[model samples]
Target chain A: MITIKKPGLLSTIQDLGRYGYQKYGVVVSGVMDSFSFRIANLLVGNEENTPAIEMTIVGPSIQFHQDSLIAICGGDLSPSIDGQTISMWRPIFVKKDSTLQFGESINGARAYLAVAGGIVVPYVMGSASTYVRGKLGGLLGRALQSGDQVEIGNLTELSKKVMDHLHTNGPAKWFVPFYKPINPIIRMLKGHEFDLFTDASKNLLINETFTITKEADRMGYRLSGPKLMQKEQKDMLSAAVSLGTIQITPDGSPIILLADRQTTGGYPKIAQVISVDLPLLAQMKPMDQVRFQMVTLEEAQHLFRKNETYLTDIKRAIKLKYR
Target chain B: MDLQFYPLGDQAVILEFGNIINPTIHKQIQVVSNYIEENPPDWMIEFTTAFTTITVFYNPEVLFYKEVCQELSHLLKNIKWDEPNEYRMIEIPVCYGGDFGPDLIEVAKTNGLTTDEVIDIHAKGEYIVYMIGFAPGFPYLGGMSEKIATPRKATPRLKIPARSVGIAGTQTGVYPIETPGGWQLIGKTPLELFLPNQEVPSLLRAGDRVHFTPISLDQYMEMEQTRS
Candidate 1:
């Protein structure tokens, strides 16, 4: 058990997310940075999709109510237990009732905290991730507040044994495989509204970089860049939109809907960021920069397959170690 | 009308029933939706509905695009997208104007009618649930009386309260959640659009008809208190 002393900015419980409900207009509000979330879970020997805490802008200051193992991942947020600095990308054990604090982030905006056995938030629509707009899932379907008590699940036999063995002295071996290299190139496929834009507008997308605006959140990242002009269109018929959809708003700004975007939209979608690179976009903070890379539909599909295979291989390797 | 499908992304395809949002294509969507729901395609996961189209999201690795297209073609040709309504009709009680809706006067003034006349036109007309989108359980109801047509607010309110009934273009509907919106506000409903604990979270689903009955502010507050 742990109690939040200070939930800086916005911190909410999340997992892989609620799916199969998009037809009803429910967007999957999962952990934004799945790569880091997975690594933190892996280090603590938790399931990849287990509910974890996602912190934006700043991490939480907390105190352990029970002796448990914890791992911090994503960003360069300097987390500390009590007063001493703690290393990320590794597991650390906290004795019951110890204070933990979060310091400044060097790069990136969001961070993920993984307990030995994930946080047990109520599952609404088959997920523990919080959907802020609808107020569904996690701590009354809202972000964590100071003084909120979060319970960690009972550990599996393996996690219990692994917890006892992990070091409290220093950072563990780097899991470089899951790390998103800074300045990532996001791959994208042409969206349905691709033809609606002028050829110059389409070409501008290939060349220009977009800085995520202040109007960014889990729903979508509103981008401020070249105002993409459609040859003609006063209002577009609303259509089904999914994650990674880069919708060009009427004023010509691109809003890349994230994990928590609306299920459908009326904005003209110029492109969709490929699935494989969505995690990178998810970690970006407001005012942080990004650039788009064009990829053929075949290439995007190939990358997605390749990524799934990589994850599969990693999972197999972890299982083999335990076996 | 025949259906035409194109790739939405690597994992999804959008089937265009026709350019127009007519009753014919809506039924076609329902038929294909039911067929696909009852007998899901090998690669298909879930499909979302729109006025004249259905976007299908599938696992590319599990089901190839070519295979899905072939299977979908057969289903599209045979299955009727225009099926009769399958869901129940729900009448929602709304309290219009005054504190219930801050923009009621603005909407009434723009429409060249007194607030009471606007309310009469709005409540008397029947509404069809064309689709649910934008937010969770947000029903896009069609069939508003053109007499009540009012332009959206020049500047969108930063926070339009949940259950604020509003109009955008020719469409009128209840705001399911408290969100920033540009719709012309006219009233508020006390009912919950979505309750996570409930088995069926949304109060309205696609194909569900909703009628707004004008009620007193006292009644609205009473229902709101009951739920709380």
Candidate 2:
């Protein structure tokens, strides 16, 4: 069991996301950074989809009641065990009664913490992700609060083996390097209504550097940059939108849809961020600058497959080391 | 039915039936959606249907973009559209006017009709649930009397109560959750549209037929109590 001493900013339990409910207008709320979330779980020998604690700009102060194997990934939040700073992106065996805390935000906006056994939370619509707006999943469908006691699930065989190895070997000597680029250049694919935009708007999209406004949240990041206007006003019926869809609002500013975006929207979409670069966008903080680069659909698919293979390689490497 | 496929990012594809929002396009969407739901492929994750399109989300790891398109094309070719339209008819009891419907008077005034006349017109109309989007269990309904058609409020309300029935332009819908909206409210219903605890959280779905029945304050209170 782990007790929340201080719940910082917006901390929620998340798996991949709640699926099979978007047709009913249910929002798919999950960890913003899937790459980091998967790595955190993998480091502790848990499945990629295992639920973990996702913290925002600030991080929670957690008190461990029992000795456990855990890993912190995604964003460098200056995590520490007791008073000593701990390395992230690798499995660490924490002693009982240890207090895990986070201080300065060295880089990135969100961080994920994974335990060997994963967090035990009732799944709503086949997911443990917290959809706070709908009050649907996670711990009472809300963010973590101070004094909240979270129960850890029974560890899998792999997790137990990894824990034993970590207990005997202290901590892993190496870790997956955290990746966060300042002013990242996010790659995107042309949207369905890409041709509807004026040439000037298209040029502005590729040329201009947009700043993530304060309106950025789990739903979307409202970018402040050159106004992108369409050729003509056309009434469009609401259609299905997805994560990383860059929609141009009536005011001309683009808003990149994120994990908690609505299933359907009526706004005219300009482009969709590629799957490979979603983690880069996920870790961006408000007021951060970013540029968009266009990529072909085939290229995007190739990049996605490459990323999947990279993760699989990491999984195999970790298994060999632990064994 | 003619189908057009467009990519919605790397993981999902949108199958557009037509650009117009009519019964024909809506029926085609429903037929295709039902087919996919009944016989979902291994790579197919889930789908969401809108007015004229159905977006099919899939796993990129299982299939490439071209393969997904081919599978969907094969599925569409096999679908039998000759089957009769099958849908559920749900009757909602609404208490219009007074505090339950703060904008009922304004809606009547905009249409140049009396409060009772507006209620009569709204209740008598048979509406079809075109899609469920915007909010959880919030149904975007069609087939309303043109006489009572009104534009949305210039300024949206910060917090419209749940189960509040409202009209915006030619469309009418019921709010399943308390959310900020611009629709002009006409009444409140006793039925709970969103049930988060149930296996099927939403009470309404696309292709369902719905009608509103006017109820007195006393009946509204009695029904509300029974439901709770």
Winning model by TM-score: 2
Each candidate: chain B TM-score: 0.92, 0.97
Per-residue lDDT of model 2, residues A1-323, tens digit only: 99999999999999999888999999998989999999999999999999999999899999999989899999989999998999999999899999999999999999999998999899888999999998878899899999999899888787888889888877788999766688889999999999999999999999999999999999999999999999997878898899999999998999999999998899998999999899999999889999999999889998898889989998998888767
User: What lDDT does candidate 2 reach at residue A100?
Assistant: 98
lDDT tens digits by residue: candidate 1, A225-312 = 8889999976777889877889888789999988787888888888998877887887787777788888887888777788777766
After superposing candidate 1 on the true structure, give the runs of residues whose Cα lies further than 4 Å from its correct spot.
Answer: A167-176, B41-43, B77-87, B101-117, B217-228
Over the stretch B1-228, how does candidate 1's per-residue lDDT look in tens digits? 677888777888899888776666676776777777788766677888888888899877776667778878877666654446476689999999987777778777877899898899888887777778888888888789887787887899999888889998788988877889899888899998865566666788776777889999889889989989
- Root-mean-square deviation of every model: 2.7, 1.0
Which numbered prediction scores highest in DockQ against the true structure? 2
Count of backbone collisions within predicted model 2: 0
In model 1, pairs of residues that clash are B27-B81, B27-B82, B27-B83, B28-B81, B28-B82, B29-B81
Clashes of each: 6, 0
Off by over 4 Å in 2: none
The Cα error of candidate 1 at residue A253, in Å, is: 1.9
